[model samples]
Target: MCLRGKQRAGRVQSRVHVDTVDPLSAVSDGVYRLDREWRFTYVNAAAAALLARRVEDMVGQRALDCFPEVAGTVIEAEYRAVFADGRDRVFTYFHAPQGRWFEIRAFADPDGLTAFIRDVDDHHRSDQRRADRVAQLTAVLEALPQATVLLDGDGRIVSANRRWTETGEVIRDAGLRPGVIGDSYLEVLSQHLTAEDRRIIGAGIGGLVTGGPRAADPPFVHDYAHAMGSQRAYFRLQAARVEPSGQVVVTHTDITERVRDQQALAWRAAHDDLTELPNRARLLELVGEALGRDPGRGALLLLGLDGFKAVNDSLGHEVGDELLRQVGARLREQVRPCDVVGRLGGDQFLVLARGCDAAEAAALAFRLRTALTRPFCAEGIPVPLTASIGVAAAQPGGDGVHQLLSDADTAAAAAKGAGRDQVHVFSPGLREAARWRLEVANRLRDGAVDELVVHYQPLVRVDTGEPEGVEALLRWQHPERGLLSPAAFLSVAEETGQLIPITRWLLGETTRQAAEWAAGGLPLRMSVNISARHFSAETLVHDVRVALHDSGLAPENLVLELTETSVAEDPTRAEDQLSLLQNSGVVVAIDDFGTGWSSLAQLLALPIGTLKIDRSLLTAAARLAAGGSGSVLTAIVSLARTIGIRSVAEGVETPAHLQMVREAGCELAQGYLLARPMPAADVPRWASRVRAAGGDSCALALRGRAH
Candidate 1:
C-alpha cells in the first residue's frame, strides 16, 4: 500500500508490526503513487516497465524528477491537478523524444496521487493518417473543374465545391441561391425539373443511395439538359457511392459544345453548300424514310430549269449561283409547309409533296412552274427563267426511291422536249419516248453518224422541167425503223449541241456528191441544209473551206439553205457569216422563207442568193389554184426578184400547183412532182430521165409557154 505523509507514520508503524502484501504490485496496468511533497511513494511493475525503470528505482523518487519527458505536457498538468484537487483525470500526450504516445489516468486521495499510464502510439498514428487523408481529399475536390457535390445517405448535401456552386447558379431558378450545405438535393430536383425529367433524375439519384439491391454500385452516369433564363446547357452527371459511409459523390460536366458540334455536323452533311438546300443524297434519304413509314403517300416533282445555261453563259457563273439560291427560295415559297424542296445539282430541283394525287401534283407543278417563271433579278440583272416539271405519283405498288426519282427525271426530260415551261406526267408512252430519246442522246454524244444518209431531190426550172439543181436532205436509215426523217432526231442533235458536227459532215458529204455528179456529167448544183447552230460555230468557215478544197468541188456549185429564223435570231452575226460564205462563192438561201418571223428589212440585209418558198405557200396557192389567185406567191416571187435572188417554190405535188407557181413567176419548183428525194446514186438517173423526156408530163403544158 502507498500512503501520503499523514498516513506515513501510521503506515510505518503498521509496516514495522505486520507483514502485508502490496496489492499495487500485482496489477497489470502501470500504477504509481505520488505524495503531497511530489515524491513517488509506490511503483508497480507495469508502471516501472512503461517508464523503462525498475520498481525500486522509481519508488521514493520525486515524480517530476523521475520523468523529465512529461514536464510541461498535458500528462503532467492533469497529474498535478489530480494531486491538488483530490480528483481523478485521464489524458494522453505524445512524447516527441521517444516517438511514443502515453495515455495516463491520475487519481488523488487525501494524502497523495495515484497514476496509471499506457502506450497508445498505434491509435495516435492512425488518427493522424485519417486527418491527412481528409486534407488530401478536400484539396482534390476543390481543384476539380467539374461541379462536384458530396451527399449523405439521406440525400442531404454534405459539401459542395466552388465549381458546383457556380454551375448551380447558372442553372438555378431566378433569385434562388439556397445554401448547398445541408440542403436536400432531392428537394432541388423536385422543385426545378419537369415531371418526366424529375422522375429520371430521381431514379438515378435513388440508385446511388440506400445501398439497396437496385442502387448502382459505383460510377452511375446519365445525361440531362437544362435551360435557365437565356442560358442553355447540357450536363453529363456521374455519381458514385462512398464506401462504408454510404455517402454519394456526384459530378456534373457541361457538354453543351460537344452536343452542338454533333448537331452541326449532321446539318452540314444533309445540305448543299451552294443553294443552302437539301442535296441529292439527303433528299434521297428523306424520301426513303418517308417511303418506309408510309408507302405511296407522296408524289415527287422533278424540275429542270430552262435556259439556265444561257444565263450562266451570258451573265457569268457568279450570277448563275445567285440565281440558283433565289430559285431555291422561290421554290420553298411555292410549296406547302410539309412539302420538301431540295436541289439535285445544276439547275435541277425536286419537290416531295405528301398525299398528293396525280391531278393535285399536276396543279402543284404548274403553280411551281409559274413561280419559277417569274424573272429572277440577280446581280442587278433581271433573268427570265422557266422550268420543265415531271410529276410522278407515289403508287400503292411501292416504288423505290431511285425508281421514283428516275421516273420523275424521265418525265422532266419529256417536258423539256414537249417545249419547256410545260409539265408532263409519267406514263408508259412517255417512258417509251424518253427511252428512245435517251438512246438518241447517247448515240449523238458518241458521234454515231453511220446511219445517216444524204438523199437528193431535183429542183426543176418551172418553164422547161429541166433539173436546175438537187437539194440534199438528211435521212436516218435505222436498222429497225427503216427510214427516219430529219424530224426524228434533229431536235436531239440541236439539244445535244451535236448539230455543228452533223452540219460539217453534211457539207463534206454533199460537196463530195456534187463532185461525183460533175464527174458523171450530171452537173447538178448541190443544196445542203444547215442548222442555226452552225452559224455560231467558230470553225464553220474553216470547215466549209476544207470541204470544198478536199472534194475539188466549186464553191459556187454548193448552196447552204437555212431557216430565216436562224438568221433573224442574231442578224449582225448572221450577216457576217453569210457574207463570209457568199464571198467564198457559196450560195446562201433562206430554206423556209415566208414561214419565219423575219422582217423585210432583215431579209434585205442578208447576203442571201436564193429564197426557197416554204410548202405552206404552195398549199395556200393550191386552195386558190382554180382562181389562179397567186397573189401571196406572186408577192414572194417579186420579193426574191427585187432582192436579185432566185425564187424556188417547194412542195409542188400537181400540175395546178406547178402552174400556179409558174404564173407567179417563180424561177424554180421542186417537190414530189419533180421527183422524190432519192439516194445520191439514183439522182443522176432521175435527172437523166428528165433531160431525155424532152418534156415531162407537166412540161408539155409548159412547152406552149416556152414556145
Candidate 2:
C-alpha cells in the first residue's frame, strides 16, 4: 500500500491506496493506519466498530478532524511521537463521545503508522474502582487520631498518615529512623529498639504481614515509653492484619496523660493527705514486704498517743491536726534509715523495724516514747504529748502482717492500761487477752446484749430503814460461763463501739422495769449508769427520751448516773445533753463520786440531784472513824446537803459502816450489810418481806449489833 499526505488548512492529511482485500481488515481488534501527515489512511471493520465511525468517511480524514476532541491531547501526542521516532507506542484512551475505554498500540513504519485498538471498558472500570478505594483508605487514615501506617505483605511501609509522619519526625532525634514509603517497617523499628523489643515487634508484625500461624489471632498490641527531648511519652502500638490482602494496619496511640494520671492516683492512694506519710494500707503493704524478707527477724512498734482525745477536745481540731503532723515528723526523725514509719490513722502510728529482736524492739520503743515526750508546738501553743508504744518482735514461724499488727496493738493496749507513757513488749498472755476481747466485742456486736439481765440493789432511807429506790446493775447470763459481771466486758464494749447500743438497750429495759414496779405499787426510783461513749455519739438525750416515752415511766422517777470520767471525756457534749435532760425532769447523779479525778468545782457545775459515795471512800471513812477521825466522809455529806443534793452511801457492809454513814448525815444507804443485789423478779418478794417485818430492814440487821 502507498500513502501520501497533503496539507490543508494548516493540518496534515493523508491518502492511501490499498488492495481489494486488505489484510488489516480481517483483524478482530479494531485496526487503523495513520500516515506521516497524521491522517487516517485506512480503517478496518473492528476499528469502525470501536470508533463508532464509517471507514469510508474516516479514510481521507485527519486523525484530529475525525476525533476532534483528541486535539492537543495525549492521543495526538502519542501518534506524533510514534511518527517522529518510528517506534511503537502503547496507551489506553477514553473515547468520550463513544463513552468507552480502549487500549491502543501504534507502530511506526517508514511511510506511515498502524494502530490496533480493543474495547477495555470493564477492565478500566474495575481498576478505577480499586484506585478509588485506595484514595478512600488514605483519607480514612489521614482522619484517624492515632498515628497510623499501612504495610504491604512484604512488611514494606506502603503508606503513612500525617500523624505518623509527624511522630516519626519527633522521634527521629531519639535514634529512630523516620518511616518512609517502601522502607521495611521492621527495619525502621530496629533502628531504635533494643534486641528484645526488636524481636517482639518483628515477630508480632511479621506474623500478621506474612500470614503466619498467629495471623488468625487477635491484633498484636504493645506498650512502650519514649523520651522525647526532656519529656517522656507513652504509646500503645496496635497491629491488625487487613484481611485477605495480608497487609497490616499499625497504629500508635499516645497515652502519656493517662499514665501520669494513673501514677498520681497510685501516689495519693498510698500516702496520707495530712501527714504525707504512708497510710494504713500502704504501711501494711510495706510491713508485709519486710516480713516477707525475714519473718523471724523483724519487729513492729505500734504507738498510741495517750490522752490525745483530751487534747483534741481541749484545743481545736485544727491544732490537733497540726499536732498530728508534728508527731508524724518526729516519728520520721526518730526512725532509723532502714526502718519505716507510717500513720495508722488518728493518734496511732506504726514503725516497721526489720532485723530487730525483742530486746532491740523494746529499746527502740523506749527511745520513741522518750522522743514523743518532748513537747510540740501546734498553732503557736505548746502541747505536751506522750505515746504508749507496744513492741512485737517477730517469732519463728510467726503469722503475717495482720497478726503482727494485732499483737503490737494488744501490747499497746496493755501499756495504756498500765498507764500512759509506758512501753510494753507483746507476750502470749496479751495475745490471749486480746483474743478474748475480740471474742467479747464480736459477741456483743452479734446481739449478745439480749443475753443480759438487770439486777437491782435496794437503796434505803437511812432514818426509816424503808426501801426507797434501787440501782440497776448489769449481769451477763453467759451461755458458756455463767453470770459475768460488768468488769468482765464493759471495757471491751466501750472500745468496740458496742457500748452505745448496750446503753440504749439498758435505757429501754430499765425504764420498762421501773414503770412496771410503780404499776405494781412498789414505786421505787430507778437508776441506770450511762457510758461516756454516749456523750461522744451525742445521742444520750434522744436515747433517754425514747426510753421514757416507750415505757410510760415518769422522768423524775428515773435517775441517770454518770462517772466523773465519762463527763470529763467530752464535757461540752455532756453539759448540753444533761441540761436538756434536767430540764425534762430527769434527775442526774454522779456515781462512785470519790473514785474519779473530778474537781469539786467541776462537780458543782453540773445539774446534780445526788452523790453516790463510792465504797472506797466509805470504807476509808469507817476505818478513820474507829480512830476518831471521820472528817472526810462527814464533809462530803455536809457538802452534798449544803447543795441540796441527797447523799447515798455505797458499800455499807457492816453495822459500823451503816452507823458511820448515818452519823455522817447521809440520806440513803445501800450495801451487802442490808441486802445483796437481787433479780427483778426477786425485788418484789424482798420488798414484801421487808414490809411484812414492819418496814425496818436496816433495823432488823442492826438489832444484832444493838444486842
Candidate 3:
C-alpha cells in the first residue's frame, strides 16, 4: 500500500495505494507508517485502538495533523529524525493528552517509516510506590523519642534520626560520636564502652547483621550511666534486627529517675522517719551481724526514758519529737565508733557496742545517763530527763539478738524499779522478776474482778471526830500469796491495759456496797480512786451512770477522786469530763493535790468539790507545826476555802499529825489512827461498834482544837 500527501490550501492532503504487503496489520502492538511528508499511509488495528480512531480515516491523513498535541514535541521530533537519517530509534514518552506512558520504536523502511508503541503505565506506578515507602519510613524514625541509628548488613551506619544527630554531639566527649552515614559504628563506639558492655553490644549487633539463631526473640538491651552536663544520666541501648532485611537498629533512652527512685525506696526501708536512725528491724539486723562476726566481743544496752510521756502530754507532740531527735544525737556522741545507736520506738532506744564487755557497756550507760540528765532545752523549753539503762553481755554463741534484747529489757525494768537514772547488768533475779510480772499481768487480765476486793478507810471530821466518809483501796487476794497491796500489782495491771476493766469492776462494786450500807441504816459517803486511764475514757460518764443505776445508789453519795497528774493531762478535755460528772450530782475530788505541777489557773478551771493533801505534804506540815509555823498547810486550806472546795488531810497517824490538822484548819482526816482499811464486810461491824462505844466521834473528830 502506498500513501501520498498533496498540499491543498496550506493543509496536507494524503493518497493511498493498497497494492503492497500490509505488514503493520498483522501485529498485536500498535503500528502506523508515515512517508517523508508525515502523512499516515497505513494504520493497524492496535494503533487505532491505542489512539481511539478509525484506520480508514487515518490512512491518508498527516500523522502530526491527525494528532495536533504531538505536532512540535519531542515524540514528533524523534519520529522525523528516524525518517531523515534512516536510523532505527527506540524511545519512551508520556502522552499528557491521553494520560498514558508509551514505549515506541521507529524503524526506517524502504517504502516508509514504521513506528511501534506499547503502554508502560504499570512500571511507572511501581517506581512511584517505592519512593513513597522510603519517605514514610524516614518520617517515622524522625518522630521517635529515642536516638536511633540504622546500620547496613555490612555493619556500617546507613541512616540516623534527628535525635541521633543531637545526642552524638553531646556524648562526643565520651568518645561515642558514630552517627555519620557509611561509617563503622562498632569501631567508633568501642573506645567509649567498657569491655563488658562491648561484649554485650557486639554479640547483639552480630546477631542482627549475621542473622544467627536470634530471629524469633526480641531485641537485646544494654544499660549504662554517664555524666551529661551537670547531672548524671542513665541510658538503655536496645539493638533490634529488622525483618526481611538483616539490618540493625539501635536506640538510646534515659532512665535516670527510675534508678533514683529505686535507691530512695531502699534507703527508706531501713531508716526511721522521725529520728533518721536505724529502726527496730535494721537494728536487729546490725546486732545479728555484729554477733556473727565476734560472738563474745559485743554487748547490748537498752535505755528507757523516764517522764517522757508527761512531756508529750503537757507540752505537745511536736516538742516531744524534737526532744527525741536531740536524744538520738546525744546517744550517737556518747557511743564508740564501732557502736550503733538506734531508736526501737517511742521513749526507747538500743545500742549495740562492738568489742565491749559488760563493764564497758555499764560505763557507757552511765555516761549516757549523765549526758541525758542535763536538761534538754530545745524549743526553748527546759525539760528534765533521765534514762534507765540495762546492759547484757554477749553469751559466746549461746543466745540470739531477741534473747539479748529481752534480757536487757528485763534489767532495764529492774533499773526503773530501783528508782530510775541508774544502770543495771542483766542478772538471774531480773529474769525471775520479769517472769513474775508477766504472770501477774496474765492473772490480772483473767480474774481481776474475782481476785480483787475493796477495803474502806474512814475519813473523820477534824473538829467533832465523827465518821463522815470512807475511801476505798484496791487489794488483790492472790491465790498463792497473802493479800497484795496496789503497789505490788497495780503497775503491771496498768501496763498490760487490764486497769480499765478492773477500774470498772471497782466502781460498780463500791457503789453496790455503799447502797447496801445505806439500806442497813449505816449511811456514809463513798470515795473511789479513779486512774487517769479511766478518767480519760470516752465512756467515763456513761460508765458512772450505769454503775449508779445498776447499784441503786444516789449520785451524790459517790465521790470520784483523781490524782493531780491525771487532772493535769489535757486540762481542757479533763474539764469537759469533770463537768459532765459534776452536772450529774457526783462530787469530784483532786487526790494527792500538791504532788503534781498543776498551775493555779488549772486548779481554778477544773470543776472540783474537794482537795486531798498528800501524805508527804501533811507530814511536812506536821513537822513545821511543831515549830509553830504551819504556814504551808494554812495556805492550802485557805486556798481551798477561797475556791469553794473543802480540804482533807491524809496520813494523820500521830497525835502531832491530828494536832497539826486541827491547827491548820483542815476539814477532814484519814489515817491508820482513824481506822485502818478493812474489808467491805467488816466496815459495817467496825462502824456499829465504834458508834455503840461512843468512840466514833472521839476517834474521827477532834473534841476540841489542839493546844
Scored by TM-score, the top model is 1
Error of 2 at 132 (Å): 13
TM-score: which is higher, 1 or 2?
1
Candidate of highest lDDT: 2
> How does candidate 3 score on lDDT?
0.82
Better structure of 2 and 3 per TM-score: 2
Model 2 error, position 517 (Å): 5.6
Q: 458-512, model 2: which lDDT tens digit per residue?
A: 9999988999989999999999989999998999999888889888999999999
Q: Kindly list the per-residue Cα lDDT of model 3 for residues 1-707, writing each as its tens digit.
A: 23334434322323333344556667889988888888876777788888877766687678877888897877888987887789999998888878988889999998669899887777866656644643555576688888877777898887788998887888776544545888887886665666887888788777778887765268788886655546677778888877655667788787788878977887788888899898899999999999899888888899999978988988999999999999999999989898999999999999999988889888888999999988988688899889999998888765698988899998888889888888999987887878888889888767756989889998888887778889999999988887999988888888888888888888899999999999998888999988888766666788889999999999999899999888787687778888999999999999997788889668867899989999999877767767887468988898888879999999877777877778878998898767789998888887876687575554533333232
Off by over 4 Å in 2: 1-199, 214-217, 227-231, 241-249, 296-326, 342-351, 355-368, 374-449, 460-468, 492-525, 533-559, 570-587, 619-631, 654-667, 684-707
Per-model lDDT: 0.81, 0.87, 0.82
Clashing pairs for model 1 are none
TM per prediction: 0.73, 0.67, 0.58
Arrange candidates by TM-score, descending. Answer: 1, 2, 3
- Residue 442, model 3, lDDT: 81
